[model samples]
Target: MICVDASGVRLAQPDKVLFDGLDVTISRGDRVAVVGVNGSGKTTLLRILTGALRPDSGEVRFGRGVRIAMLEQDPLLPPGTVADYLGDGWEVAAVATSLGVLPLFDRPTDQLSGGQAKRVALAKMLAENGVGAAAEHDMIVLDEPTNHLDLEAIEWLEARLVSMSAALVLVTHDRHALDRLTTQVGPSKVVELDAGRAFVHQAAKGSSAYATYLDARAERVDREAKEESTRKILARKELAWLRRGAPARSTKPKARLRSANEIVSGGPRDLGVRGNDLELGAGSTRLGNQVVELVGVGQRFAVDGSDAVTVFRDVDLVIEPGARLAVVGPNGSGKTTLLDIIAGRRAPALGQMKVGSTVVVGYADQHAASLDPDITVRQMVAGPLREPDHEDKALLERFWFDSTAQYAPTRMLSGGEKRRLQLVMVLARKPNLLILDEPTNDLDLDTLRSLEEFLDDWPGAVVLASHDRAFLDRVADHVLAIEPGGTMRRVPGGVTGWLEERSTRRSASPVRTTKVADAATSSSAGAGASGGGVAAGSRGKQKQASSGPSPSTIGRRLRETEQAMVKAQKRVDDLHAELASTADHVVLAQRGEALAVAQGELDELEARWLELAELQDG
Candidate 1:
């Protein structure tokens, strides 16, 4: 059955046309997604599909008696508290609890932050979708549903959506959600909005719709470039014939001549720009001995005039030059608070933080708090200068803010455009230390990849908190996981290891209460695998005040221990597999012998690694 059918759709903004004569149809069990650049009308398309916004000229029809639930990017709640808005029911409670909305149930909806509002909206939408009821909405549309959600919440939502019977339509920049929904459990469709056109791709029976669409789109762009080249060649030949053949030129057919002239004057097809992604030049300032040091740092928040709630406690962190640290944890687990304290935006409840004299911090917080909404993009990039220079204009263009967009007020820009502008402003000053909180939020995939590339060779210290697993894998050298109850751990295998440990724990205890500090993983680096830690590279050495070996000596030993630990772990795994599958007594004996040796080596490495971590903490 058809859920929604729209044809001959056309929408135009004051500056340019969004889409023209676009056609889309959503059927039962269809998992459809919308993808595009920041201001490429993704949200606008969603609005048109959900009947919230009417197209200039289009035919939209919904299946008879089919119910629809739509979650907007920034939903306006009815005037009331969250409890009043959501009402009472076990189904609502379950969904709200899973989404971390239970705590805010008594708070007024209008007082909630952007993330809180998004979660409330998501919970309401899921509840209405008949999570545990017989009659549910036929279709559910969500705009950036994964925004502000932690990794665990995102996976939970993904599972819920997979189990539902309702058709799903969502817009997001999350690669994991997109890939899993479109490939793992799907016969999905992807609607790609590019260059004022909507290209709908239908996945094959066992194929990945999103991946296929990307490949096909790149091929299309390449084909267009080739055709443009062919046209130019033909046009050049015609020009030569017209200019050189003097007497015969007058005798040539006037219609053919006009056609040739038009082709010669016409510009090339707008396949895309050469380098639309952000180009980040590393900071020029040389970082001193100290980057940012935290001693016994902790944060506490008072709740509803009651006792102050402790977020995290006793976090002793040292960020030196060439260090790439990524923080991960569930929502409201003090990831952002830790980053804020490091950036010196807010002082910890109890701690001593020392900022190096030579350090210049460039912070990109969750919200674009530093921006003035009324100012134009050009004005923001130009700083206090009266006008943006030629270089400033070029810089804006590189970030995908065109000439028209550059002059437009920042308030008018899309969510992604605003985020991009924030990056431009932050990097413009060239800081040696970067503290990014949820930097991947609202950014398009192209810009995200470009940033990952930039950080691969960035000569500075980076501390960021993100729920983007792929982004963390590419950028972070160490994984700093803050479990619920403020017990931070250092995992060896980056995000993958942290995820495995989280999954294993969840499996072992199906029902567990959070915020009760686990005694097993007491502090940041005392326990757990110890390969992922501060990389005191050749660029600079840390200055240690405690009585011990020099920073360089420990750093060298730490690197050596990490490499040996990896080999030892691998050997142990191989031997264990051999012992499990073998029936030969001789083979079993040999494998056992090898396993013992490998285990002993791994234990020594872990102890040495832990000792180094304690030294760094001291």
Candidate 2:
């Protein structure tokens, strides 16, 4: 059954067309992911689909008795407490609890943080789908649903969405969620928008459709370039012939002359600058042996102006030169606080923190709060240098800030453009110690990829706290996991290890298994894993799971651990051979790193096997 059908949709802005002749039919169980560059009309399309905005020339029809709900990028709420805003329902309570917004139930909605508000909005939508009711939303539309969510929350949402019966349509920059939610088979479709044109691609549920689209798009661009080059050559020849200015040419047919003129006047094309051109050049200064050192660092805050709540404690770590540390934990696990301590923005209540004198910290928070809206782009970049020059203009151009944009007030820039400007400003300082807290928040995928490439070879220490799994996988070589009870543990496989541990925990629980299928397979893998402490009733069961393994479980785990160790060792061996054979320095470095990671995984597996073996022997 068709839930919603949009026919001959056409919309335009004063400056340019957003989309033309767009036809989309959303049927029962259809999962569509709308993707494009930041301003390529993703949000606009969502608004149209949800009926918030009507296309200039299109008919939108909804199936009878088919309810729909939308989670806007930034939703507005009436004056009330968080709980009041959500209303009374078990599903609402469950979703709030899962998203770690239950604690904010009594908190006024107006006072909620951006992340808190987003979570509340998401929970409200999820609740409306009706947890176990006979009737649920037939179609659900979400725009950037994962924007402010942490990895755990994202995984949970993925799980819930997988278990949901409603058809899903979403627009997001989160590649992981996109891959999980949509598929080539069935009714899943990847609708890509480019330059006012829409291209639909069919890809499998777990496939990297976005990546595939990028490759296909690049090939198409190359082909067009080659065709254009041929035309340019003919145009040049025609101009050269016309320049002869012979009397015979004047006598030639007017039509021939007109064709000649058209060819000659084609002119040189614009370079078509892109986000990839943005150069986040490494800092001029080199980092010292010690960038930051923390000993027994702990942070606690008073909750609702009452009893002190421990966020994290007894943390010891060192940030050395060229170190890349990825922080992972549930929301409210103090990841941001950890970065704050390292950046020296906030003093830890019960720990000693030291920063080297030469280590200049460049901190980019979620919101580009350091930027002044009144200033122009050129002014912001040049303000720190205290002068504007040809060099500054050149730098701005590299970051895609044209002369017009450079002169425009910062407020006139889009969210992505503003974020890029903030990035340009931060890197201008040439800080040796770079700390990013949710740096991907407002960034386009192009800029995000460029930044990742920049950091790969950057000669400085990096501390990144982000929920972007792809970013973490590309940037981080090690992981600092803030576990429950304020204890920090280093995961051997970086993001891979953190995910593995979470996977194990989820697989072990029968309740979780029913709620969240494996993240690798399901559209949603997180429905119940909340960063908020477990409910009072579940604490005992959680404690039991945390305790030492039982006899039968130990034997089973021992066998699995042994098998994993063998596989890991084999992987390490393969990487070593590849590293030895590789001639390119870049390839060699990558293989070497892979070997090290494989060896670390092997070691961890061996250790786990030993522990299980000992328990089984007893």
Candidate 3:
């Protein structure tokens, strides 16, 4: 079923049409993810799709009885209880409980933080879908869904997406979400809108649609290479003729004489622009008895009726020397709360927390707000170094901060540049412990990758919270999964394993078989293997299969199917638990129906998998 078919969509910008004569079709069961850099009209396209704004000359047709739900970048909730906004329905109550928003049901929405508000908005949206009973809506759209969410909320949201039956259209920066959810669904098709025309391309798996731009870039490089080669050959021939006295028999070989003069006058000169060679010296600092320790730590913000709304409770954690730990959870699941406690920014409500005596903590918040907008990059770096006249100029240049940019105020720098500056300033102090929150946000992919490379070599211990799965996989050595109810669990294999486990849960297949196939396909075909007969191919296949069936392989596949079923069960359990724990009448009633559906899915998947396993065993 087509949810929306938009054609001739146009936007006014850059004194040109953004996407005039454009056409797009969103259908049921489609998980379409839109990706582009900032200012690339992603949000504008979303607005057009949702019918919030009209196209300049086109029509947007919605399927019959399609109930579209959209989560905006900044979702607004009314200043009433969550239950009140959600109509006190049993379905609403059930979604709220499972999403860990049950505690906020009776509390005023105005008291909720940005993260909490987003969670509430998501719950409300899901509740409107009849608490995942059936796809009443043809489609649901989410923009930047993971923004402002804690690690736990993000995980819950990811789980919710996996269990959702309706078609989803999402625009997000969360790489893990894109990789996992998109894997469960399929590759995102691109509807490239350029110069009043739209071109649709079927993106390949594991490759972004934006790669078309790279293809264009490669063509440009090829053209430049041909031009350079022709110029060099012509110059060489001309020089050879000129050296032979311009062909004594011919009248002064005009072309050869002209070419020689031109070469002499316009010879290439070294511009003295050195390539990027950033050298961060490896240094170590002694970590005292305890780098950081949190025992029964809890935090709550004061609100009416509730003494304090607990973000986390009874959490115990420790960061020893050289520990590269990662904290993950959903939007409001207390990853930030734990980070704040570690950074000495927030005191734990009910437990003891300590930092080592000699520890110097360098904290980088998501917004890079620690920077002084008024100061120049040189001044910022030199401020702490206390050596303005020293090698600070060279250091700034090495980080790609040009001379002019180095003198410009921090406010004038781009987001990536600012992040680089932040790194330069923080590393100048060479703190033994680094606390980074959402460090990959707003950073370009190159810078994100570079930072990961830098962190790998850095000797300092790191405690980071990031939604960038690739970055986390590269940097984090240990993973902490924070769930609702303030429970923190140490997950094995860091971010890669956590994501693999999550993907396994959603895919209903063994992760190992898929990975093995992928690995085999990616291996290079040797000269002999490339054109060899069927015998060579059979041998290759045998070799590939022989490399198989480790315990992790089976576990991953089982875990994926198991995780989906388990997640459904957990949602149902959360509803029951909420009903028993809270006196909120509306919430208790609302959860009853949602619990039934979740229990149904759990029962079905469980039985199906068990039967399959038993048949194999038999």
User: Which candidate number has the best TM-score?
Assistant: 1
Expressed as tens digits, the lDDT of each residue in 549-603 for candidate 1 is: 5443454466557768888899889889889998999988888888898899899
- Candidates sorted by lDDT, descending order? 1, 2, 3
> Whose lDDT is greatest here?
1
Full ranking by TM-score? 1, 2, 3
Task: Give lDDT tens digits, candidate 3, residues 1-618.
Answer: 788898777777643455666777888766676654333466678888988888777789989887788997668897778778877667876667556676676778888866678878988787777643553677888977776654445676788786766788887667667656665434455554433445555556656444543354346556756766676777787667767766645655666577677864543322122223344535446567467776556666654564555555555565666567788765555677788888998887877877788898888876565589898888998885465655677667656666777788888665546777887777766688888988876554345545666665565668888876767777765577654344456665656566666566547843222111222234333211100001112112332332333222232244356657777878988988977887877876777777787788888889867864443233
For all predicted structures, in order, the TM-scores are 0.81, 0.76, 0.56
**What are the RMSDs of all candidates, in order?**
11.5, 11.2, 22.1
Worst 10 residues of 3 by lDDT: 527-536
Error of 2 at 9 (Å): 3.4
Query: Which tens-of-lDDT digit does each residue in 517-590 have in candidate 2?
Result: 12112331111111111111111123223355433244335545766777898898889889778799999888
